[model samples]
Target chain A: MDLLLILFETGFWAATVRMATPLLFGTLGELICERAGVLNLGIEGIMAAGCMAGWTWVYFGGDLWTGVLFAAFVGACFGLLHAIFTVHLGLSQHVTGLGITMLGAALSSFVFRMLLPNITTPPKIIPFAPVKIPVLSDIPVVGEILFRQSPMTMLALVAVVAVAYVLKKTPAGLALCMTGENPSAVESQGLSVFAIRTTAVVIGSAFMAVGGAFLTLSAFDAFYIGMVNGRGWICIALVVFASWNPGKALVGTLIFAAFDALQMRVQQQTAVALPYQFYLMMPYIFSIVALIVMSRRSAYPKALLVPFRKGER
Target chain B: MRLEPRAHTSMAMTILVPVGAAALALMSCSVLILWAGASPFLALTLLVKGSLGSVFALSETLTRTIPLIFTGLAAAVAFRAKLWNIGAEGQFYLGACAATWLGTGAIDLPPPLLIPLLFAAGAIAGGLWLLGPTLLKTRLAVDEVVTTLLLNFVVLLFVNWLVFGPWKDPMAMGWPQAEPVVDAALLPPLVAKTRLHGGLLIAVFAAVLFWVVMKYTTWGYEIRAVGNNQAGATFAGIPIDRVVIRTALLSGGIAGCAGVSELLGVKGYLTLDLSPGFGYSGIVVAMLAGLHPLGVLLSALFIAALSIGADSMSRALNISNYIADIATAISLLAVLAGMMLTRYRIRFR
Candidate 1:
């Protein structure tokens, strides 16, 4: 009973928000890519690259925001590479994404070693402080958990709203959806399917990069080798779990985040005899269950993973 | 630009595309070398020398090639069936865990029987690890890519739990590793002086067996038909679901052999870092080999040499060993790009 009370505390919610912030960013990004009929498996390496890029920029005396911009820029370039392979060259999406992942990971580690060689202790930067909203901070539980959070958390929420609006209400969104569902239809309608997909992939990757930047620049002070770990992969699973709906993605990400937050707290607050790895495995297990439950009859984009050439079947 | 499909691809084109792709990858990677302030010529030389220059280097390269062969074949078999078994890493760990369990248990069996039993245990465990994803893919219409990738993390944790919790070595001070297997369980060295083990022979035998199965068997024909066109295969009376399950079982089983080879042939104990992305690297090998069983052997050896060479180049040139990874990724992308270009000739509008 005491543990249940601790689990519902404002601090626990705050941790949940922190854990969910990166996933939200990555989930939103991958959602856009998948909705546009391209499964960007490069998210793992792109997120890792962005995390390292953001940290390196900040370490070189750039502001946190500028560091984030650099990460987005790096991510966009990688997205372009993915677009060239999957769209222009008509290669296998699975292999292309995996190759991009391998490339991004190798480049990030290589650049990091060259820049920071042989440091016994890893260098740290000042992470983002929680910014309390003026009136919102006055609310009891919600204010403490939601208002008193990193700037990235607020931006992520705004991104969800923005993505939902753009995908639902805009002409570009309709065109993007059409491109994913049937490229021939979109091409017949005189919109360049390739161009729309390229734009979606680039913008989506930028969002993913920001999620990664949040980890290094706001959530944590320094970048570690496995910092991005499988979070990017989790985002991929989240796309299927959420059925590619931006609003549902927000809810799904938080559920996964709550699991993560609970595990972190349980490891700290109780003398539970369970292996710590079990805690680490919880979110993945939950996501897998979510996928199994949600993937069937999910109505994925029709042309997903199909390469579109002008008149080819 | 417009691309025109060629009715027939020539024999020369088949050999030339991969070589040209490799050369292009090397040329592109040289830019990174230049950025790192190293001579590309010297780095290339050191890479070749380190990988193939001496008998010891050659032996080490072949030793590394052993696990890769099993994994490469694993990917090759699955990719040919278009099943996309990407959980080789996790399956490898499960195989290693099973081998460790059987080898360390107090059975006191004879060497010949013990070794084959360990191999079977490894293969069975790997196949079982993939069973969940296979069922989901076959029955629920779930995407295997996410499920398989997720299983890798789950099994990795399971392996970690085994080593850190129940299987922690009693003698090691603080390392998270399993106890060493009995001597009778270890694979005997094939060469007298070198580290080469009987595992190489098994890998080669498996490769030949895989080639024969893929080439001559009716099951292989069904697998190819399903891969080329699923609906067509079903219309032609092929049991698509059964083929998928059997292929996954074989794929996972082959990957599991890689784990057993590593344990009984090389490490003799389970550790967290046993596989350095062999499962993932196997994908690259299978793709490079065009998913051919025989070709996987050559590609695996080539990749193994590149990795071994990269280690030496890193030490000699004071560059990060990840340069090899960059080169490898470029090679994969280049190969895909080459294959695309080779299939159709581009013409200006």
Candidate 2:
């Protein structure tokens, strides 16, 4: 009865959907990059940059929606930097990505310190409020779980459908997949591998940033250092579990978020007097388990981590 | 413009490229300095003065480089084998835990016996920490990057649990930390008045040893072969799995040594903030060294001075000490370009 009471609660499912929003963005972003045969290790830092960019925009008196766009733009700039090295110069994607992560996180931290030298606590902004859908909100439990949410969550759902549709149906999607699977084949088709891959990385990085922005702009009031807190890394694991499909990514993210939400509930409700750190470690431990469980069955991009030179055989 | 293959990079280019990249990094930092309302020129002088102005400053910088050398070698060794051990931070913490567990009243012994025992225990613990991920990668086709990175959060939480729950120092009025290591376990001071310790000798020795092993040994040759092309290395009769597992042990062990080096030499106990991202910084150091063992020595020193210099610069300017991190990140990015230039030349039509 107790378990049923907790499971049937609408608030828990709402929290699950709320937590899934950022991860959906991140998993989709990573799915885009990996589909184009690039492993963006920079997702963690790009999200951090997004968190800062969106919050800083709002903190400096910009409106919420523009803050989201600005975060995407900033994410794109870092993407350009990543693309220049990994796509253009053909450096090791691992090192380049880790460097980008450091740069993004450090730059945001530096800018934050400069902007607010004297404040002890992080400055708060008017975060995105949950907006109710008229007809849908009146419906039963599913309506509360899905319809009554932040606009960013709706945008994330739209992105998932859009990404899934584009990847499955569009001409551009075919080119992107070819660029990942076999760049030489794509090149022979008279399309520039460089162009397609760069676009995917840049666009993918933007989604990652939006995922980050959702945290500060919608999920929480202000940015704190390390607040991204390995969500980016977990999203990478989720993408693996999703097997590179946007729809599956949405499903995987929701499931993971449910577990995360459930853990928080259990930690709060349990009277066993457990240390909170163990509960905090669960997400990471779950991701490692997820990777092992799902890694074998997934079909990876063929040219992943391989640099495609212009004319080398 | 396009990149064209260079038949061979000249001797001058090899030396000039990294130097130019480092200078480019410095020039970019000047912009940040200007943004912080300080003159870049004076800041540069102060950075130099702060990092190398006196014997004390030099010792502090050297003391900082000690752990970097171990972690740098850790990353360099694993990266050479294409192991992708991003969990050096986690391994470093676990290593510190081992030192804490054994060195803190588990068994009391003289300095000569206790110090080596602690270092050995730390290395084994660190190696075992990575062994699990490496096994998962080798056996199950799982990607180690994600697992290793995620483990950092896991290990940090574990450390939090230990310090706050079981290992709490009751003497310190509830500030969560483990008990200090016995005095016999303490590293002999390298300089009387400074924080510098004899662990610098161990680190330098480790670097020299790594240089020899990486450059000359047949095992080293196998590591390079596997990293260059795993398919080729497998075809050439290399046991891919064994080499990876072996490299994991060595790499993780080195990173673990860094933790012990910090615990025994500097802090003398385990705490939450034992490292200010030394494990992550090791990746920066290794890449900047181009994953060369001897190069790790100089690059570690450079990174050490840069951060220490920034700390000093922050005192004079209104800027935060994070400027050094920005500068280091820029230099690493620049190094990527410099790395490419060494292998190719740009052509415009």
Candidate 3:
């Protein structure tokens, strides 16, 4: 009973929230892109680029926020490249996205080696620290778990609300959604589906970049190869799990993060003979299960991977 | 300018597109080399010399090409049916595990029986690894993309658990590796004083078989029809579901062979990082070949040479080897961009 209570302690919840912060950013970014009819598989590479850009900037005396902004800019550039390929040139989404990811990963590694050659110890920067909200953080368990959090975590929550609002109550969001569902309908409504999709890809990629930046800036201080480590891929699955809803994406991210945090805690504390790698595999397994259950009936956008050419049926 | 579909694409343009893309990619990659503080010309020359200049270099390049050929054929076969088996990486690992299990067993089987058994074990394991996703895709109509991709992570973790827990060698001190396979299980080297092995023959034979089957077989005709237009194929009485399942099995089985070849023919034991993204690279090769089985042979060799050359280029230029990956990626993108030119013509508005 005491062990169970320990598992549910304030620290665990805090860790869960911290873990979910990056996924929250990534999921929302993917949601925006998918909602606009472009499946950006370049998330993996874009995130890696963001990780490197942010780490390099912060390592070289740039302000942390500046590093974050730079990462977002780089991510947006990748998004632009994706848009030019899938949107304008009408290439295969799978091929183009995968290509960008390969390029981004290679570029990041190459640049990292050039910048920090032959270091015995991995380089580090002072990461973002938790800030306690006045009066709110003093209010017992809730305050300890939620009120005392990093700036990035706070921004993640705000983003959820902002995205939900934009998606539900705005004309632009409706256009974006329509483009994914039926480009013909969107075209009949006198809106440029191309412009909306491009905008969504750029903005969505910026969010993904910020998510990557959060990993290097908030999750840890050092940039390493494979650091993004399929998190972007997880977000892609989460978008399906959440059924293209931003609010549900937040919930899904939290659930995945909670499993991760719990697994780490259990591996550290339990005397069980099970391999610790299974603990690491929990979130991925859960996502797969969720996909198996929900994918058949999942409300994917109709024109999600289809390229739109003007005046074509 | 606006792009319009061509009534019939010319054969000359089909060959011209990828080469043009390669040249374009080479030009862009030079900018990256310039950023790395090296002369692009020097780096390019070094790459060619290092990958193909000497007999030894050519041998190493061919050695790399061995696994790629298997994987490329894996993708080519499945893509021909329009099935995306993204779990080739997972299948490779699973196949390796099976080969390792059989190879390290106590039975003192003769070389002929033991070698073929190991190969068969790998093929079976790879097919089984893909069974779940294939069933889900065919039966429930679930998107194989997400399922297959996610399975890669799951199977990788499974392999990690095996190496770290049940299969960890007691003699290696702390390195994560399984016990070495029996000497009979190891592939015979093809060349003296080179790492080239008999597995290259298997890869070549598989590529030839794929080309022959895809070109001459009735099943191949049906698969091509289904890939081009599923509804049309169904209307013409092709068993689409059966085709999908069969294709997935063969695709995964060939990928499994790639893993076993790497294990028995090269590494000789199960270890982490065995693939080095061979599965993902297979997709690149498949696309570069325009999903043709015969073309896969040439594309895989091209890609293998590029990576092998990148190592020597990096050593000579004092730059990161990742430059090769960038060059490969740029080439892939350029191919996609140029591919449009073969199928469509741009007209000034």
TM-score of chain A of each: 0.97, 0.98, 0.97
What TM-score would every model get versus the actual structure?
0.98, 0.99, 0.97
Top candidate when judged by DockQ against the true structure: 2
**lDDT by residue (tens digit), candidate 3, A247-295:** 9998999988988887787788778747877777777778778777878
**What residue runs in model 2 are displaced by over 4 Å at the alpha carbon?**
none
Is model 2 an incorrect, acceptable, medium or high docking prediction?
A: high
Which candidate leads in lDDT? 2
Writing each residue's lDDT as its tens digit, candidate 2 over A51-104 gives 999999999999999999999999899888898889988889998999999999
Enumerate clash totals for all models, in the order shown: 0, 0, 0
Model 1 spans > 4 angstroms off:
none
Of candidates 2 and 1, the better by DockQ: 2
TM-score of 2: 0.99
| DockQ winner, 1 or 3 | 1
* Candidate 3 docking DockQ: 0.72
lDDT string for model 2 (B1-349, tens) is 7889889878888667667777888899999999899999999999988898999999999999999999999999999999999999999999999999999998989999999999999999999999999999999989999999999999999999999989988896888889999999999999899999999999999999988888899889999999999999999999999999999999999999999999999999899999999999999888888898888998899899999999998987878888998888888888878989998888989
